[model samples]
Target: DIEIHVHPFALSYCSHGYRPQEVLPFTGSMGPFFNVFCATIVSLSLWRIRNPKLLPLLMWAGTAYIAEGVAMFIDIAGLPILTDWGKVIIIGGVSPVIIGILGIIFVTIGSIFMLLLMPLENVSHRDSFGKKYLITTSISFYFLLSVIYTSIFVLFVLDNRLIAFFSSIVFSLLLTTIYNPIFPFLDRLSHTKTFQIGWSEVKIALGSAFGIVIIVLVFF
Candidate 1:
């Protein structure tokens, strides 16, 4: 399972020592929704790697995605920079820990893959796949976030709509800004097409595990 440790801030606000499940249980409504939601987000992040052309738009939209993921991750674990190794730097590149060890690996591999497929220049012939995928995926992310955010707004009206909305905004900004600097380093790794071959299969395996978790959560 995805073990999460909560932030200290939550402890001050809520009377309990922070725990992942208490803050965001992956069962009931959140189970199925997050299952579908994170899968889409993962697919979106893998954009340029899958089709070299779509890098621009996918990266543009990834800004928001990186924010959402990081924001929630922070709300859970505070500054994840405290993770093992503190920080990692290399002769050729660097990786800032955005969430945890897994996050570092995900972005690292993604950057390598995307960088491999990077265009030598702004070549026009390579634009078709990029444009088509971006349009389709961005629209999908928007649709899902829109419905999810709006529902959170309406359903939680009795409690704290303001925090919820602000949380969404923070999430948007966090996802975008966090990934921008990291991409270049990943590019430097120079593992584009080959990275995708391994990463995609891993994604499929992880996704299967996620689906089973969701099913178990919902039923058991």
Candidate 2:
């Protein structure tokens, strides 16, 4: 059974002198969370492609961002941002509730950045390194923060310093190595509209979705 495998893994973890102060909480309604993300992405992509005019682009962009921002706040509002607003009551909504909101916002912001980098009908200085550098910075920051969070999570869950540090360093380095050189290369491909939100874009989206699926399948 899967529990048998997980049990030894848990026991081996305890034997290694790692333990959690408290078991991590369960996430509720994961399916809805996934639905929101996929639907939101699809909506935003459709909005982008359908808007031949700039006004339509801005309208949809603003609407999407506001929707995503509201979603993120639903989770984060209780995490010290605005607990008094009664968001943390926990009577409703999904697990890692904050992640539900945050993940979508990340995608939303990512879409906005893409729009900025390649405005609907203009080609001024977007090809310049100066412009793309900002986008690069945003992405690198996400990678770095993600690695740090992973490290803390590893330490908390598995309770093995060696494994935690090893994984963190190795993973962070790998991400950096691949990420550092990938931006400008990706930026170059943006000259053509066909590849704008095509293969490369889908690769990132599907990779994220697949990762979530793997995690849920492996864990709770």
Candidate 3:
């Protein structure tokens, strides 16, 4: 049900005009180093901050670093990138063109929702409608970004366009339904005393994992 224009890069690269294989060696080598450098800066900056909200950003960074590291290694091994799994998700790699339009819609919707619904800094307190709104918007944007990136990765791998669009609609609607109901309960749970204690534990674990990610990226 969606229409998309394939990026010009796909067309330009088809004739071995600019072989991705040539760049893969360099990118596969340097990407992790760059990620490690960035992670180091983030880890240092985070030590001076007390706001727990930044944990999500750190986790996202760590996740991408790990994923890129895997993808790069796979590329080095002459294998398809791990990030290209979106093709697998799109009905067994048959019709993949819809991902581009889906990406555009997701990003546009997410950005608009974030601009309108993201809360003020002091809206962190429990039982506030602003807090719930912020959580909903954040979760929505996270999923949208995840899907967009994966779809782009698949495009990079497959380089095929002019495929069916309707196949992905049901999956998107299902995800919408699943995420919408959970946020209300998540908001309620956050206000409980037990949740506070559990949250602290989770925060500590995330902090530890963030540090470990930085160490791994820097060293290995």
Q: Model 1 TM-score? A: 0.28
Indicate the TM-score of model 2: 0.29
Q: Extract clashing residue pairs from model 2.
A: 18-159, 28-95
Q: Which scores greater on TM-score, model 1 or model 3? A: 3
Q: Model 3, 85: alpha-carbon shift in Å?
A: 18
Q: Please report, in order, the local distance difference test score of every candidate based on alpha carbons.
A: 0.38, 0.41, 0.38
Clashing pairs in 3: none
lDDT of 1 by residue, 1-220 (tens): 4344322111111243544543222222233235335644765676535642344333433333333333333433533343222222111123434334544444343333323333322222234544323332432353454446545554443233345345544443443343335546655553343223345544654466456545644544
Each candidate's clash count: 10, 2, 0
What global local distance difference test value does model 1 have?
Answer: 0.38
Of candidate 1, the 10-residue stretch with the lowest lDDT total is: 5-14
TM-score versus the correct structure, for each prediction = 0.28, 0.29, 0.29
Give the C-alpha miss distance for residue 81 in model 1, angstroms.
22
lDDT of 2: 0.41
